[model samples]
Target: MDLIADILLAAGALGAGIYCLVLGRRLNRFNDLEKGVGGAVAVLSAQVDDLTKTLSSAQNTAAGSAQTLTDLTQRAEEMSRKLEFQMASLHDIPDTPAREATATPAAPVSAQTTSEPMFVRHRAAEAHQ
Candidate 1:
């Protein structure tokens, strides 16, 4: 009976050792740097970093564009106000001015007419002189 018990104990120990060896190999593969969960985690981390940088740059560009648009809007409003003032002033002016009464009667214009129209062109250099 003692010899049989000792043999059974030895067999159990051998089986446990084999099981431990297989589990250790599986754990090593699961945590491998390449073709494993660890590799996927590493790739995802790099992608996150890249996306963060891109988002920051996009925000900066948007801020600059907003500032430029604000400046342009202010300039447009100022120009609109000036134009309104000019239009209001235009309303104050009369369409026709009062002509002074002449003592002598005006002569009638000639009835002569021409079929062809005439045009005059002046040179820039001659006009200055």
Candidate 2:
């Protein structure tokens, strides 16, 4: 009976030792995993910071572009108004002299009939024809 008890006790001790070894190894692995995760978090934080900076720069650029576009639009509108004003002013000019000039007639052919030479008479006759 004593020999059997000693053997049982030794077997239990061996099992407990094995369990502790495995548990310690597992604990070490968990610690290593924790360190790896911490490193990854740091890297991610740096990446986020970089992304934030890039976003800010992009926003600033967009604001500047919007301002430039606004200025260009205002200039275009001003130019359009000036063109409209010039066109309106042109419509106010009088056409009376133009109409009178177009209405006036040449001298009568009978008045210059004798003084005109042969070529002029020929042209006049051609025009009359």
RMSD of each: 12.5, 10.2
The local distance difference test score of model 1 is: 0.84
lDDT of 2 by residue, 24-101 (tens): 887676556347555667778899999999999999999999999999999999999999999999898755577675
Q: Which candidate number maximizes TM-score?
A: 1
Writing each residue's lDDT as its tens digit, candidate 1 over 1-129 gives 999999999999999999999999998888788987988888999999999999999999999999999999999999999999999999986554446225444434342255544555669868899
> All candidates' TM-scores?
0.60, 0.48
lDDT of 1 at 99: 60
**Separate clash counts for every candidate:** 0, 0
**Cα displacement (Å) at residue 113, model 1:** 40
Clashing pairs in 2: none
Per-candidate Cα lDDT values, in order, are: 0.84, 0.84
